[model samples]
Target: MLEIKAVTKKFGNDIAVDHLNMVLEPGRVMGLIGQNGAGKTTTFRMILDFIQPTSGSILWNNQPIDLKAKQRIGFLPEERGLYQKITVEEQILYFAELHGMRRSDARQALMEWMKRLDVVGKVTDKVQKLSKGNAQKVQLIASVIFQPEFVILDEPFSGLDPVNMSIMMSEIQRLRDQGAMIIFSSHDMNNVSHISDDLTMLKKGKTVLQGGLKEIRERYGRTKLYIESPLTMSQLRSIPGVTQVTAQENGLLVELADENVGKVIFEKATANGYIPAFSQQPPTLDDIFRMEVAADV
Candidate 1:
């Protein structure tokens, strides 16, 4: 288990991270999300001991994490960290060796990881020769080459297409199933929603929301209605208790001031005689994100 107990980081008079507390156990995935300057990277740095925290403590298994424990952690920063001139196999082996693996074992692990991660091209090919997506895959392979017990991935899906995203997600799940504690940051709310067991949302270095995704949504309540029909946005907004209506592909996402207003919209939809679909559910993560961070804009 990893515990971040009231951890805070400061630069002179400016505070980058403010009293953030979190507990992550093995086999759990925690998603850290916020705007660009929300201190996600700073928190990761503190966890990795790249920079010391100005206050509080970071512990692994109830003890302060040290050099020996650092070997078990894997980090994939938001920026690409690779030698463009090196071959993909060499890069993976280099990272594995840094974690104390023997050359022969590292080479064997590289071959197996390449096959499992579905990395393209030959092992001898230079990192500079691969496409953007393939290069990202190689970087991901390096992060997990030694099978670290704790993994931190920042924007791991940056250059991935839908199919590649699916592949990366599968690999991350595999790591979690092996009892690794994973913490990742992503601007992609949909991907975060699908992957994270729980979420810790930050804004201006402060934790704005933190909890299991389902519980958070349930607590936020069912205030949004999804309707796929001929009814236009204007018509939906004109209904009593309906406060906002946003048009979406094949539907209008209608926001209600009162939950009971959903029934009114349902009746109106029935009268129009073209009800393809109707669902009243809690707001999505995307919706909650915008709502929580709207003041920052």
Candidate 2:
């Protein structure tokens, strides 16, 4: 288990992280999210010992994380950093060795990862020779080639297309199945909601929300309704407790002040006959993220 309790960080007088607490258990994935400069990177640095926290403690299995513990952790930075002059094999093996894997084993592991991530180059190819997407894949390979017990990924899906992003998501789930506690940060709410068992949102330097993904969304109530029916926008807005109604290409988005208002909309829409689609759901992760950010403004 990884634990961070009341962790805070400051650079001179500017607080970068404020009294943050988190726990990550084996085989579970936690998604940390925030806008740029929201202190997500600072929290990762503190855990990596790249910088000391201003206060509070970070522990690995109830003991302070030391060099040995550090070796057990894998980290992929937000910024991609692959040496431009080295062979892919040389680059990944170097990292694996530094993390305590033997050269022969790491070499084999590099071959496996190249195939697993669908990296489109030979092991002998120099890092600079690969395309931007393929280079990112190599960097990800280096981070987890040794099969570290805990992994931290910062924007692993940043620049990928839909196909590549799906590939990365599948590999992340595989890692979690192997009992690696994973913590990652991403700006994409869709990716976060798809893979994360738990979610944490940070703003400025403080946590605005943190909890299980389903639990967090449920807390906001089922206030969003999507329907593709003959009901006009004005008709939806006419219902009591309905706050907003907007026409969409295939449906209408109806915002409710009370979840119970869904019953009224349902009855009225179905009074004539069946509608093509009707989905009443709690605020999505995207919705909650926007609400929190907008609240600050």
Candidate 3:
């Protein structure tokens, strides 16, 4: 397990990360989310020992993370790093050697990874020759070439299309299933909701929310509702406890001040007997994310 206890980072007078606490167990994936400059990167850097926290401790198991432990962690930073002139084989083998893998083993691993990820070109191709998506895949392959026990990925899904995103998600899940502790940061709430077993939300460098995704969403109650019926817009707006009603292509999205309001809407919509759809559920991660940001502002 990886534990971050009351970790705080300061630069002169500014607090980049403020007393953040988190735990990542093997086989679990943690999602770190916040707007830009909210300190997501700072937290990752502290874990990688790229920088030191002003106060607090970061540990793996029962001891502080030292050089040996650091070597077992794989990191993919938000900023992409690859030499345009280097061949794909050379680049990956270099990183693999840096992490203490034998060059021959690294060579075999690179071949397997490239094929598994469906890179369009061969290892002999220069890094600059690959498309953006392929280059990103190669970068991801580099991060995990040695199959580290812990992984940190920053914006792993950025710029990926739906299909490529699915591919990336599959790979992340595979790593988790293999008992590698994983933590990643992404602005895409859909991806986070799909993969995260634990979540931490930050606002201005302070943790505003942290817990299991379901546990946190349940606390907000299932106030988001959707329905397809003959009910007019004004009719929904007039109902008590009805906070907002917006029309979508297929139906109306209703936000109730209380989940109980859903029963009332249901009774009214189904009075004549049949309705196409009625769904009352917890606010999605996207909704919660916006609410948190707005609440702080």
Best by lDDT: 3
Q: For candidate 3, what is the lDDT?
A: 0.93
- List candidate 3 segments past 4 Å from native: none
44, model 3: CA deviation in Å?
0.4
- Report the alpha-carbon TM-score of model 1 versus the true structure: 0.91
lDDT of each: 0.89, 0.93, 0.93
Off by over 4 Å in 1: 228-235, 246-251, 267-275
- Listed in order, each prediction's TM-score against the native is 0.91, 0.97, 0.97
Q: Could you tell me the lDDT of residue 126 within candidate 1?
A: 94
Residue 191's lDDT within candidate 3 is 97
Please provide, for model 3 over 124-169, each residue's C-alpha lDDT reduced to its tens digit, 9 standing for 90 to 100.
Answer: 9999999988898899999999999999999888888787899889
Candidate 1 lDDT over residue span 1-297, tens digit each: 999999999999988999999999999999999989999999999998899999999999998888888888988988887899999888888888888778899898888877876778888999999987788888888888888999999888887888789988988889999999899998999999998998999898899999999998877778988899778888887788888888877888888878888887888789957688898999899989999999652
What residue pairs are clashing in model 2?
none
Clashes of each: 0, 0, 0
